[model samples]
Target: MAEPSITIRDNGPYVVTMPVEILDAKGNPLTITRERITLCRCGASNNKPFCDGTHNKINFESQVSA
Candidate 1:
């Protein structure tokens, strides 16, 4: 099995590529059907943890470097 890869997008969501599961507050797994997932960053997404392209409308700016 391959390891997961995560990328922080500029002014966007956290792009993740893995086979890991996303659990909720109750420890229940969220239903998702995609090879990759984009998580919210600006805390203004209607989808909560998921990215609904709300950052672009709010003009969120964040660039990560290591």
Candidate 2:
């Protein structure tokens, strides 16, 4: 079983990137890929679940966790 992982970038429009396999409720893989994905953290992206450089206007801040 391969575990999925997400990476958060500080200098990019995407707050987080993850290689995911979309699955059904029963854990069946859907039509998804293992490619890198960008997620919006500023909550102002017209494209949900993806980053569109909307964070620049909102001045989003992220706290680094140790």
Candidate 3:
């Protein structure tokens, strides 16, 4: 059986609700999921990739102007 994969939607807030196994660079399991998670993409988060509601402070927008 293959390991379960999580889908990350582009230009949107990445949310993870299900239990998942976090891994290290060497394919080793780092930690098991205990709660929900939200990741940031704007690079303005003080949490550095983790949602800390800081995106709102810097007016971080994910949509690109075409």
Candidate 4:
């Protein structure tokens, strides 16, 4: 396994790399299959944490630096 990395996108979700485990409020885990995943940051996703591309409509802004 590779060292996990998190990438903050420009006005978008936080891109996360696997193999990783994300826990819910009940201490359950989210089932992830993709090697890379996008998590919501704008707090607009119908599916919280995971992005549903709502930022584009709400005009959220944030720049990510390497």
TM per candidate: 0.87, 0.55, 0.53, 0.86
Native RMSD of candidate 4 (Å): 1.7
Judge candidate 3 at residue 18 and give its lDDT: 50
Q: Rank the candidates by lDDT, best first.
A: 4, 1, 2, 3
**Candidate 3 ranges beyond 4 A from true positions:** 1-12, 24-33, 64-66
Residue 10 deviation, candidate 4, in Å?
1.4
RMSD of 1: 1.5
Q: Model 1: per-residue lDDT, tens digit, 1-66? A: 457788899889998886779899999998887878999988999998999999999999998888
Candidate ranking (TM-score, best to worst)? 1, 4, 2, 3
lDDT of each: 0.89, 0.61, 0.60, 0.90
Question: Candidate 3 at residue 34, lDDT?
Answer: 44
**Pairs in clash, predicted candidate 4:** none
Model 4 per-residue lDDT tens digits across residues 1-66: 667888899989998998879999999999988898899999999988899899988999999786
Q: Native-vs-model 4 lDDT?
A: 0.90
lDDT of 1 at 56: 97
- How good is model 3 by TM-score? 0.53
**C-alpha RMSD between model 2 and the true structure:** 4.7
lDDT of 2 by residue, 1-66 (tens): 335566566644443224455556788865545455677666788876568887777777774444
